[model samples]
Target: MGTLPVAKKKKAGRQKCSSKPVKLPDDASAEELARLARAVAHPARVRILRLLTDRETCICGEIVAELPLAQSTVSQHLKILKESGMIQGEI
Candidate 1:
């Protein structure tokens, strides 16, 4: 079966996200805001975070069982969320 390829990021210009809830500090960089917004943009990533947030822990293999995506793909997604500080794990 062919896996649905992840969409390439759109190279739109640095459009100001006026809808941002809280105004960021002056010291925050554009790249930092963009990265944070991107991390919470996916449904799968949101689900993973929600699961961990409630349970307080989960292994990579368990996530794979709950998601349609492959284990490696789920791990990659988890890594991104973890790196972005939206989630944490035992390991």
Candidate 2:
């Protein structure tokens, strides 16, 4: 009998977006800053946004195909961008 490899489960814990929706310095809400930080945290995400910003339109699936990352990872990155108001999802 052949052995099958086991798949690891991913972590899906809750994260607090901000302490409160209080006014921020420079009119940048804490949430917005956090979101921007998340977007710029990863090099891949930077690349992803750069591609989308320069292209007429970018398909999420195409990004996964272009980058040497797992499809799910790329999707996560896309989700971050969408949440950050930096990009939109077409499908």
Candidate 3:
């Protein structure tokens, strides 16, 4: 019997968004736009936002399950989202 080779998991590095920034209307404050931009700067956070919007609610464990991240990492992402006013919840 041939043995299957196990693939090594690569360590995740910081990812940068390659898309150009959209010009917002003059009414929006630069600080507000920066805050919101920081909130979604990570792919994981974006995924979490999508997951929450899809169901209206979710626990930290649920979000962790959907992403390939650790519980602590997910919690950190959630914290950034909350601080940026992107999301709100006890978890």
True-structure lDDT of candidate 2:
0.54
State the C-alpha lDDT per candidate.
0.54, 0.54, 0.59
**For all candidates, what are the clash counts?**
0, 0, 0
TM-score of each: 0.58, 0.60, 0.67
Q: Tell me the tens digit of each residue's lDDT in model 1 across 45-85.
A: 87865555444234556557888998767767866865654
TM-score of 2: 0.60
Instruction: Give candidate 2's root-mean-square deviation (CA, Å).
Output: 14.9
Give the winner by lDDT: 3
- lDDT of model 1 at position 60: 59
Give the Cα error of residue 16 in candidate 1, in Å.
37
Segments in model 2 whose C-alpha atoms lie over 4 Å from true places: 1-26
TM-score of 3: 0.67
